[model samples]
Target: MDNVSWWAVASALAAGCLGLSVPGLLATLPLRLRPLPRLALAAPASLALIGCVGVIDGLLHLRFHWSHVLIAAAVIAAVLWPIREKRPLWSCPRLSALLPVTASAVSSVAFALVLLHQVPSFDLFSQSYDNLFHLNATQSILETGNASSLQLRTLINTDRTLSTYPAGWHTAAAMICQITGVSIGVAFNALAIAVVSVAWLPGIAWLTSLVVPQRQRTAGLCASLLLGTAFGFFPYALLIWGVLYPTFLAYALFPSGLALAMLLAHVWLPRWAPAVSDQVRPWAWNDRWMLLGLAAVWWLGAFFTHPRSLVSMVLLIVPLVLWICARAIAVAWKAGGARRRRMLWWLGGAFAFVSVAAVAAILVVFRVFHVASRPVGDHLNGPQAQAVQTVWDGLWQVLTQNALVGLGLDMTGSLIILAVVVLTGLVIALRRADLRWMVVAYALIAVLFALAAGSNSDMTKILTGLWYKDRYRLSALLPLLGVPLATLAVLRIAALTRWPRVVALGSATIVAASGWAGLWAPVGAAAAHEYRLENVKTTDFVDSRQIAFMQQVADVVPADQLLLGDPWDGSGLSWLYADRRPVFPHLNGQWDPDRLLIAQHLDQIESDPAVCTALRHLNVHYLLVSTGEFDGGDPSGNKFAAIDAAVSQGLFTPVLSDGESALLRIDQCS
Candidate 1:
């Protein structure tokens, strides 16, 4: 088979094999109880299995190759073989009615896949700044055969500590790349598209299935389609804008994690905390063990994939638990005397336990998300006008900005419309048990956003400490609350109007179109070959000539010698694609002491023996000069001045020149 064909086959087998594993089967149990088709479980199951594989590989130090993945799959299959003989995949009796919803979700994914496939070259490498670490880190995982980020530090800087960064995405991509002989970049991009299409799209459908009534599946499905398509920041913007592949993967898995938590909470809480039974109708399903197991596996998937996502789940889940406790206490009070005291004590213990657990979890989060070695008290810089503007901007963007809108559908207008409709629906059906949870969820998110939007430095620290204080990251999660309310609004409006279907379709169409507008450039950029240095500065087309020049330098430079190059000139790609390590692995040069030292005297390297002494210390071999786009405009302070000075002082000899860039051997270093 050709390389592309091999990649398809390998990726299919890796995902398929994972799906057939024990955790994969376990993860499908809760979803199986729903009236959805078996295929709905494929993506989530596959992703959960990938997380399982990551854990196994990390512990065993196994190389992330097809052989290792297959072995792990075999072990899981072996354990589950006896159970599979007795029970087959569940068949949905309502499959005929559910086909449209399923088809809509699948089609949305397929459309996204087509757009992603059309991107130029399919080289899979992102042109964004952050992709330097992401792409190189994946390459490191492949080279070392260690899927654990803890030990995968050789790619970026050898001085960096054991990494706490999530490695599940990299491991999955590395498996595809190793098995198919594709580049890590190609595998990574393909994996990302697959995640959005297969994992995220279906996962949303599954969450909708959990939240919406069985009869109203179509409304929920429609809402998911709009969410998958129309929302720009979530699956698309996060993928393209920040090139946050790990975060995207975590977010994609979040719906499934939430759905599983909802199921488990509904079922398990009643038995453990019976005082909370007034608010929760204890589900007495025969598959209780299966549901518990499924929730555990999904939570594991979330924790390993991205801690931020796991934290989001906790925030959402806590409100439901508190509501349950509050309801039980109210019911106990109505019953009077001993029952009230008993319920109080029960809830008091529960509250204490939850408090302790939350504190412990937050500590873990603080450590995992910590920005190591940075000066903490160096206050964050913001524009003078931003303090007040950010309060509104952060709150508004959290609610409405991520998705694209048009045809006079302003985000503020949309929010006002949706709020009016949802509140109207809640009043119309005040007895809905589900509405309570929905309201609680929305309220919790609003509170989080309020804290996030606070102008105080401490609030900023809290937000950053919790979710990187990134508005984009917070916005990426808005759809979870946004989509459900949107669906509710459409349904409520339909119930009020004589033409329900018309109202629903109209809302879906507006949402879908507006969202599609937001994603046009990002999706189109694939084929357009555009790359963004940052969100504001975008290069229309990737310059392949510059890439070729870097590759030539990589080929000539000794493997052990470190080269110095400006990261903004895309030297990180050389480390990833050409196996050449640049002094600065990331675009920001302020963090690394050694890199900062080199940068401080780069222009004086030819005349300054001290600078030459540092160069010799690093075993520096060459300097790469790019005649392309870079951060700073000054030629003197930038890489050009340093190169010109070196040449004038006869301290270096030009070994290769490609007009676009050049490689200078440090032959006359001090």
Candidate 2:
């Protein structure tokens, strides 16, 4: 990478930490959470702020800048200040508290190192299908200054009708780009790294600490290590598989969301509910309305980022909800000694009514997200296609610590060790009532993963269809609570050991290594490092040679000129990197008639008047033609066959050329 590229990546990483973290910390000021919980919750709050900023600018039709984020954050903090508790949100933590913080930092470094290994360059992007939309959408937000989720689908929608999309993730990328002046690609990679480290690593660490009995000083450290490195399927798997940017981010911050749910479930019901007033209560929060206000901020964040996170929240939080309801029922039973039958009926009626309301709310959410319209990918096989069976398959995978995604990382030794760890956790959950709800939550998501991954039944579609029956999406949701259970289990095992610190550190190292390469690999660290290095040593997408050539193309191709080529052939990226618009800016879409006509008959420009007319109408001034395409990624050439023929006939003059790719001026079109 050149110095400019290096600067872009470094600046993005640095600026992203401040831009992403501060807004959230300020936003959480009014909420009655401890400093630790507040710190953990900041990521989600920052996401909410960014999402709102994007939507606000979209409505105002103005360019986004660093000022917007800071100004909005300032406004939010100032407004919330009067209502803020006299108890400050931040204070120096005890030296002992820094154990979790230290674990968070060390674990964050490990997580980042692996991710940096996976995506080696800031310029690297997924060669997959969805990323084309993501890249184009991000560029559109940066260029047009419209970041509204409702309007983002217009980039591919053609008719300008409002199409639903979760633009928060894409918007954040654009924010990074504008703030740091980095290309969309680098900005994206930098933001992903930042989210994992600044947002996810600490969030999971705090959640794990919360799950442990507080006296278990090592809970945060163990949780950070276990959750960050012990598992390959999540936090890492999601990054590889769709590059699943939106889902990855939402799920990353989802621990905080889950933490919030746990907080409300444990504290709100018992303390604030009128029926439970007679019960022992201990929380500074006297107002139920204030708690709901905190939830509203999280909702706004989740809603804009991805509605699926909300559904994921509901899925995981159900067990807790049930637990809370069960407690309410018991409380009503005690209070209803005299009119027990009448009180029981009232309680039952309330439960039934709430259940119906929840169902209705879920349906509304599904409709808003256009869940029914999304494709389920039944034709395309996933990681679940092989090495697994349908019924209870996801359940089995979780229990055994099996990886569903391709790129084999499984080892017998690692499997045995992890299996014992996870199963011990499950066994522990069964005995501990407080942790039982987490197990329930993990099981529910796993069941969904199974149905999505293996089943093709009508019922499967109905049940998992909310995720469009995409196993990757379901699999990503599985680890939200799964890691915490694993963390608790490691803590339990450490308690039984003579050298708990050594055991904890060693276990953390071995498990993280197991996920990367193998447990017993030669000199544990060396093997894991070599394995990660080999995977990212060479990327399958566009290379530095191609990037250099593209930069040259950008110099020659004027901003006003439009390039025409197949998106599948990689010509669509001209818009993102070169600032030269492409006639086809994405891989596949319900394209307008003009673009389709040109795609079908661009070579017939001299013979076909319609082709000539379309070319002129669309302002075709250049052509980006790749002579050879990516392995298995090449288009059929049926659509671009015209352009290939035109170039073969020497109809256009090459402005520049790299071995198989070139930028040509469109004199032939006339």
Model 2 stretches with alpha carbons more than 4 Å out: 1-10, 87-89, 118-122, 271-281, 330-394, 407-414, 496-541, 630-655, 668-670
User: Scored by Cα lDDT, where does model 2 land?
Assistant: 0.67
Model 1 TM-score? 0.76
- Residues 103-208, candidate 1, lDDT per residue (tens digit)? 4655465445534655534554556556767776777676666677555544454456454666767777776666566776567766766676556666666666
Query: Please, what is the whole-model Cα lDDT of each candidate in the order they appear?
Result: 0.57, 0.67
Give per-model CA RMSD: 6.4, 5.2
The lDDT of model 1 is: 0.57
| lDDT string, candidate 2, 292-319, tens digits | 6667777787787778656767777778
Models 1 onward score TM values of: 0.76, 0.84
The 10-residue segment with the lowest total lDDT in model 2:
272-281
Worst 10-residue lDDT window for candidate 1 reads 404-413
